[model samples]
Target chain A: MDGNKILVLDDVSVRYRKQDSRSTSDIVKRILGKSPRNNEFWALKNVSFSLERGDMLGVIGKNGAGKSTMMKAISGTLTPASGTIEKTGKICALLELGTGFDREMTVKENVYLRGAFMGYSKEFIDSKYDEIIDFAEMREFQNSPFRTLSSGMKSRIAFAIASMIEPDIIILDEIFAVGDGDFRKKSQQKMQSIIDNGDTTALMVSHSLQSVRAQCNKVLWLDKGRMVMFGDPNTVCDAYAEYLNTGKLPQTESLAATQENPRNRLKKNTGKRLAEAAVYLMLLLVIIAGCFVWSQYDLLKSYVLAQSLTVEQIENEAANYHRQIDRLLEVDTTRWDTGIFKEGALDIINEEATYTDVAKEVLLQAGDLSRDQYKKALAAAEIEAIKYSHMARLDALVAQMRTEFEAQPEGKYRSLMVYAYTNCDRFYDLEEDCENDMQKVIEEIRTFQRKAGQSEDLADRVWNAYKSEKTYLLSYYCVKLR
Target chain B: MTSDKANHRFLLSELIRRDFIKKYKRTTFGILWSALSPLFLLLTMDVVFGTFFGRNMPHYTIYLFCGLLLFNYFSAATRSAMRVLYDNAQIYSKVPVPKHYFLISQSVAQAIDFAVSLLVFFIFVAIDGINFHWRFLYLLFPMVCLYFINFGIGMFLSTLYIFFRDINYLWPVVTRIIMYASAIFYDPSILPGIMRRLLNCNPLYMCVDYFRQLIIHSTVPSLSTHLIMIVMAAICALLGWFTYHITRDKIALYV
Candidate 1:
């Protein structure tokens, strides 16, 4: 590792696809689906530079010279299409004025939010929060939404936040362009302080040749994405200044003497390879985990369902079973015969209907059954018991009611009807009984009405009850007869 | 490195807070809008769908509310997520923070809004005479599943939006179709089995139906239903993350 070098760009280049051309021919071509002719070009090409810790590099270039692109590449915003960039430590960037802030948020919230964006913990921000606000000289405006601040105020806060955090690297892209004179002096002092610390690297892109010449230890000059010179600040800045004033390109020979440093160049491709591997690994993990979860979904669902519902519904009837369910969740699910576990959970739910000693014995024997046959036998036993209970009660009630109705043939009477809707199929034990009982009751009521001949009013009452209940049971009933 | 992770978590919460504050800024109703907005929407839907053809069905308002609530949250979260990259271009374009953080933050803000509306929904359920059951707590499962699915869809849509402005017009129409197909107003149970199965394939419909199962019918959705939800959430999240990851390099330039 090059201990002194904190940032390295080895033959870095970035390409941008040109915005869709608006010409009539292009539109027609697009509409015709000919893939709108590839219009991408390199914005930055083969730009190699390295920054030692605490080295402040000034980048000077004319408009469209890819200066900002290089800053973005260095700041970790834009990825290089064809080369590698290796940098260590966090970067604090002021790519543009008011660029990274939510304008509608209060100034304080934006500061914390941005601080979080830069990977500073809230406790750290809380400690430095007052100092940041004070340095920006916006104590009163801190509570006001960020958009309400003037441009100068915005720049001040932006600079204060960027500078205050003490980042390992700072990228300033024409940040000095907007602020007032006093604020500029303050920010320059702050930059000087950062540089004097002798460990924080800084990259500033500026059109102001004077400040670049004064503040930067090294300078890079670019023209149309090609590096013109990279070396001592005076030599490169003077060449750039002359190019601007006289419209003459610097001499190649003169610039060759100040070529990029050899010692700082990165010698390994490990960083890029590692990043690529991590992403692929993540993709693999997502796929594997997905399949694993999918295959085990029944087990997972059983475990989660049992655990969640057991807390609320099964506490009183099957309190002892709670520990079993809890242990089912805690133990390794991969080893589970989920068929048995699921059946066991369903049987526990049917613990409510396990009134008879025979059913209780069957429930007790559930643990001994073969895993495959367990679900079916346990479910059948639970269902049969539940059916016997509900059906026997209904049959007895109907038999007694028939005798009473026959004796009171001339009297007006109100009959109570119970509708047992078998709508809850999830309750495995109750569904069959409810469905059979519902059909039987409906048939029995029809026959009784046919025999009573004078039961027209009773027919209307039963129809009303059916209409109000809407096909499912568990509703009020008003069966009347005369 | 630990501090960085902690800060990223802090960043997520702060960004969510910022989105929440921005959403309510200068509005008179403020947080109250979270509850009242859904109610107002429910009232309009009730007037249109409930009174006209739904009088015979018990608790039709609650049924409609259940569908509308989930759909609105899904649409709002995803719609906001689609714009997250473009809207916060100033932030992530310059900073080194993960772009999905902003997407998650915006989506979470919408979730908090949905949570408030859910409380109101429960109140409505009580008023409609639907008994609250132990299964109602199972809502957290679907809510979590819906969030991941929405986050996944948001990632997919936001990437599309960066490359194609056509999606700006296309997405609302897609959301409308999702709303109609999700059986938000009408019950899917009345539909033919194949049609209902096709509709249930939509993850949004599954989430809506989960709510109906818990709140309207007071039953835990079948374990298979739970499986579908988990599978859907996982697949959508993976697909969204994969697309976002693959295209992330190209995004900054286009945005």
Candidate 2:
């Protein structure tokens, strides 16, 4: 935490909860009083390091080995689940390419935007704009939208904006990977210039061992999130490069390897033993209940069959009706009217119907029915046809009604009232049995009126129909009686 | 520190101006696209909504655009801010400056667009022979306040995004939800009491409401109410700045 020591990490460790490899249903069952297995994974463990001002530290690690996590912890993006970090200085970081450039904005604007993001003001950006653009080598198309720029171009722009703003300590996260050969050379030069300035301390994360050797004075080797080796660039790089060549520790093992003592190993082993014991017990329980589970399967199978049968019945009846209509249309063109096709056809196709009676009818007329039906009635084809025709007819009727309603609004309202009155008349004809149905029609019309919020004249038209149509009136009374 | 702030400010202006020009560099109409994009969007929204929500809407497009222009600036700026840290992660990774500048830059860029769109709005109003009112200048008060509010939101989100990339996907849904909930297209007065209250809670509502009052109603909104709104904006900006300061170091890693 001293001024000279720009960054320090003491025994930093990161752990993430690992999900159990169980189905969602299994998890739900566990939630409902059933016990679930537990698992945890450590991404970083017992990592310790320090960096001083003027020292260029290069962090090298394999992908997913917690290099990024460690960087994140140091950067303050991630709080280490354990351990402590003390730092001093204004830290600047270049974590990714084009981290702040607005693609829709020009290079100049993106620079300003980047500057502002770094807490700079508009006037400040104005002064440095040209220099930043010049460094990026994008002056020719600085006014072009960033989206129009190539990936390499975007990277250069981002790099230029970042490097232009001088900070006490700068962090670069694999930005050297961006751009072409020429631009890469320029980027390298720019990085060297920053380092040469002497006031800025830097941390660079890269996979390029050569770059680390050339540019960095202090090197940190991170293996699976732990500091494997640290200190002089040549020594750390040699050890790291050797470790890569052979999947083993260096011949002269670094202190980090021996730092994991027997006590820690015992603790880790005990944790593993506990987890294994729990898994064994669960496996034993499964084996003990294997017989009971088999017996219960029969009951569950029956229940599933019962539910599936209901669905099958509906599907069969719809198909049968659809076939009947298709046959009728094929045989007698005069009997079928295309104009009657409407929008509720699909809904009708999906309706449930008692298919036992239809099956009996089909069996009785096996000899007289078409060859197609005789061959496929038992195979579900007949049922499918019936469903299709019924749906098509319903759809046509709905479509016709909608068209008429739109074409003649007043007449449509009159017709609705007349229908309601007819239902009312039927109340008496059916000995008050139709009362409920009549009342439902009146209620539906009232609901429509409420929802319409139309002018009084429109409401009057509907009301007049209700008054004049005797059936509608009788149906309304019948409904009241019910 | 003062010199640093000045240097940063100069750099920010250049970025914003570049951002503005870059938006239309390739198009045939070029800069005119700035004026036309909003116009096209306004007209399309008007026609589409006019068929369903036309009644009670006097000059529906104008009314909608008034609120839209202001809201668009806020929305676009905040949306860009969501990615500001990640987009400029390169710069932050290498340079050290206060992170709020990026949020401000995005807001400023949007302000420029808002300015261009405002001109288009007024031109249409004049051509339509809409009455002129001196009170229209009062609209600037809310607009300026709204700019700060956007900056605050941008700072908070950009910092949050660095930690949770998921914030990126969630942001658009949140914006859309707020858009409909706010009085961007409809009059807040027509909404139910509960809904109206809820709408008032939206910070953008105050800005949009003020814009409508000044431009359409030709009257000044309650000064105290606006002052309260400005205070709210200031609080948001402060909170955003604090959050960025606290989380600024972490952004490079998370991004």
Candidate 3:
């Protein structure tokens, strides 16, 4: 390791054990004095490279060519099975964007979160919030929840936050490949500016050889875990292109191995290989556990609030019942989200934030359209009935009730009869209390009785039946005089 | 290097803030839910277990809440920590901070929530006619101890979860088992001698039992209990810290 070099890799290699020992029986057998054969694959080998201050090296390799493994080692995320890596500087990498973003948090909140993960202070982030938002063109949407934004918008926000660091060494993995044409140009210019500042060294991995050739001072090429070439961008990329084109090595002289680049004689760690090899998922009961909790602020609040409000018979019960059936909704969904009018459970739905209202509906309905249709018709009819009085109200209410009664065989007319009785009782009670307008009330009752589809002699027939039975349930005052 | 430490602390606080906000965002009741959730659990447990233990236990709800408060902090902290690496994989793979920061941030956030919920617990204490003695202040010792244990358990679980994702599913069940074993509801005195002895082995139970000794019994636990709590905490912290250090670099690869 040279003192002036920002990073030095002396024949670093990473090895992954094969899948033989992953089986429990195999592991058990191995534990019981049975030695397992060597089964391993080297993902990277002898990948020696060095960088000085302000040096930009572009890494190019095909899939499974050890490019990502090298990046992981350089970023200090993955340890090498053999060889050694030494670096001297504050380093940061952008291997992925929006990695830790909480889907429910706002863009501004995500900025702080991403910054925290990047190890930046809040004061520094606070100072740069405007610049970050401005760069992403997300000034208006800074407060919107991250899940609400488009995937493209999310990447832009992530990029803006990741680009704010001014560390001595920066590692980037396919960050410029995000966003649209305009955004791509904007970020590319930003990357160019960061490089031009002259103090930071960078190692970039890209499939775009044209970009690497244009931007990098030197390029490193790899093919199937071997370092094919490490030299000027034109020479290395041309050689890589020729190799890909012809399926053979380009006849070019290799970079002379300097005194610093020795045949790295680091010890291989066979013990560490065991743990990483058995990393495949355990053969255990895979419970659908993510089902337990949801964004419960709404659910819990709704639970407490739902308890305090007075029950409005069917309407409140329907809301409560809807919320109750859903395991998650049982905890959340307040009246604000679920706009239920008291007369009979008519929901004035807000299309944008309907889930806060509709999630319970799903839990209760669960793609059952018959119940939904009945509910919609019932609610609409109830609202219509309550909007009018006497004749018109009874006519419409009975029509709706009959339709609802006919649709479902289970409830029959039981539910409708109860509602109708309640309505009749309410109307009669109104007629009795309105002593000042007895004539008008009586006329209204007569009109409603006709609206019920009764003939003109119905009152006479009812009087005769009452006389025959010797029953005088209705007094002269209680009866509507014709 | 001074800026580096400052940076870590600042990052820690920001993570805590994010955890807090993400949990309660768009929630109607916000932080009040944190306090109210325990009260809700206490009521359910009291009703279900009330007939069995209510008559025998003095101030049954208060006793239940004391144990619940501590166990809940552990559950919340570890649950939060459990998902820190996997959930944050998108960022964790990119950013180069030490992996333990994620777990530490979760613990701190849960600690803040636990602290807030305690305020609500005090409200109940007042309503239940529980007297405010100077000894109530002694509850701070167990509270601090509980926080450390929570952080330690969280770190350990987070590391295990990175390697074996089944641990995520296993966690809630484990916490429930701990809660039941911790004597959160029924009295341990009702158990057989062997089982009661085993309760001493569970760090979670020991912490909860000590906390109850402070808040409910209104006295310091005997020196042995104190020593047990301290030793268990140290062991958990050391184990968790060691696990984290060993597995820290490997976590990125798994993600």
Report how far off residue B254 is in candidate 3 (Å): 2.4
Question: Residues A396-473, candidate 1, lDDT per residue (tens digit)?
Answer: 555665567677764333232422222222222445555455555555566666777645554455444454443222
Better of 1 and 2 by DockQ: 1
How does residue A370 of candidate 1 score in lDDT?
35
CAPRI classification of candidate 2: incorrect
Residue by residue across B211-237, what tens digits does model 2's lDDT show? Answer: 777777677876545755766676667
Candidate 2 fraction of reference contacts recovered: 0.28
RMSD (CA, angstroms), candidate 1: 14.8
For model 2, residues A1-482, the per-residue Cα lDDT tens digits are 57688788777776554652445575578789676444445677777778877879898988877776776567655555566778775566676676545556666666765666555656656788888889888899987777788888878887887688776667788888778999889888988988988878888899999989998999888776566788898998888788889888654344344343212432442355456656655544554365345334434443443345565764654456565655554553232222222112322344532343333233332212333442333233333434445434434544565566577776444455445443433543555555455555556556555766733343344344444543333333323322
Model 3 global lDDT (CA atoms, 0 to 1): 0.66
Name the candidate that leads on TM-score: 1
Which residue ranges in model 1 land beyond 4 Å of their true spot?
Answer: A20-38, A238-482, B52-56
Highest DockQ, which number?
Answer: 1
Model 2 residue B67 distance off true place after TM-score fit, in angstroms: 3.9
How good is model 1 by TM-score?
Answer: 0.69
Runs in model 3 deviating more than 4 A are A1-3, A16-26, A29-40, A96-100, A250-482
Task: Give the per-residue lDDT of model 3 (tens digit) for A202-304.
Answer: 8899999999999999899876677879989998888889878988865433323311322245454434554543331111111112212222323444444
Which scores better on lDDT, 2 or 3?
Answer: 3
Q: All models: lDDT?
A: 0.73, 0.65, 0.66
